[model samples]
Target: MSIQDFFIFNCLEEKDLPLLHRWFQEPHVKKWWPVPKEKEDFFDSYLKRIHSTEISLYFVSYGNIPIGFLQAYPVDRSKETWLPKLPKNTIGIDQFIGEIDFVGKGYGTSFIKKFIDQLLAENNEMTVILDPDPRNKAAIRCYEKVGFVRVGIFPRKGDLALLMRYN
Candidate 1:
């Protein structure tokens, strides 16, 4: 079964952090974001804020078995590190398929596509933005396939990426 088969957004709970930590240690995650060395630190310090931010929302799902993590935040409200002048209330999504076995099953793409559609519906004036590493060509292609356009590049602390906008 795919994420499309049973995709719903739910808030991240205390019990969910164990699974999230497992996902973080997976090979797929390390390949994409390889800085954090400890899972305890990530959750205690970072994941605690999943519920507070109105502009940023996170979901925990059992995508055919609940083995992934997904998060979306307003472009203006979340990480102001690498985006251009976003539309007034625009939201940006940053997600990952941590289960290596689930990597190429179209789950990640389907989840984001559906989620973005819902976000846009709510904030019609918003523009969704993303910045995928230019080195990761496959990801760039996937974003383009879903109607995101390469807007420009912005440099972050460690990596520089191709900024994309979905309007």
Candidate 2:
């Protein structure tokens, strides 16, 4: 199905935290998006920054049902060393399909493409970036399918990551 067939991006809300926490606990998701050992701790820390001006958090929905999480922030606001090489208006993204049933279904590529299209439409001068673990071949392939090019690998938070850009 096209993105229009089953996708809507909506602002994350407090009510969504429980499902989000469950997603975080999933082995596949936790490997990439590590959270606190306690769910409450994770909720406390994440909720505190959900509405930050420096970033935007979204829930990816399929026919109005939330299925995933996505976030975007200015590259300059990031602590990653490689982000400084990009233009100041560059934005970085992080995303995951929270619903296990949706994994490997090609929704990620469509969602990312549509989301980036919207971002570009809203800000003509902005560039978008994504950093996924190089070991995650599936994710790398997905990003490549959405027009993201591999720029290079960089160390981020004690791990090496593959940096991809869509401009």
Candidate 3:
């Protein structure tokens, strides 16, 4: 389905923490997004990090149902010291379908493309990027469907990921 027909991006809020935490605990989400090892302090750390960072966290809703979480950040504002050289207006994104029921559907590609449309509309010259685990074939294909090309592989915390970019 087309994005306008269903998908909506909503900025995250404190009230969504419990829902976010529950999603993170799901096997599908936990496999990809391993939050703090200390589950007891996950919310504490998450709140501090989200509030203090220069990133935007959003929930992807499909037909009024929240099904996923997405986060975007400017590469230059990142705390990572090993980030490769990126364009001046590069925006990086990471996302996952938090709701298991939504997995394998066409929502991911459509939602991401729509989000990119919004970003590019705001700044047509800006670049969009993402790093997905090399083994994540599904994610790689979804990104490719959205017009992002694989730049190269990059090491992130001892794990290798493919750096995909869209201009």
What C-alpha lDDT, on a 0 to 100 scale, does residue 80 get in candidate 2?
A: 63
| Candidate 1 backbone clash number | 2
lDDT of 1: 0.70
Query: Which residues of candidate 3, in runs, are more than 4 Å off?
Result: 1-4
Worst 10 residues of 1 by lDDT: 55-64
Instruction: Give the per-residue lDDT of model 1 (tens digit) for 15-134.
Output: 777777777777767677654577767777556566467445455355446756666765553457455566676666777776677677776777778778787678677778887888
Candidate 1 vs candidate 2: the TM-score winner is 2
Clashing pairs in 3: none
Q: Which stretches in model 2 have alpha-carbon errors above 4 Å? A: none
Q: Would you list the C-alpha lDDT of every candidate in the order shown? A: 0.70, 0.86, 0.85
On TM-score, the leading prediction is 2
Model 2 clash pairs are none
- Backbone clash total for model 2 is 0
Report the alpha-carbon TM-score of model 1 versus the true structure: 0.84
TM-score-wise, the better of 1 and 3 is: 3
Once model 2 is optimally superposed onto the true structure by TM-score, how far is the C-alpha of residue 3 displaced, in angstroms? Answer: 3.2
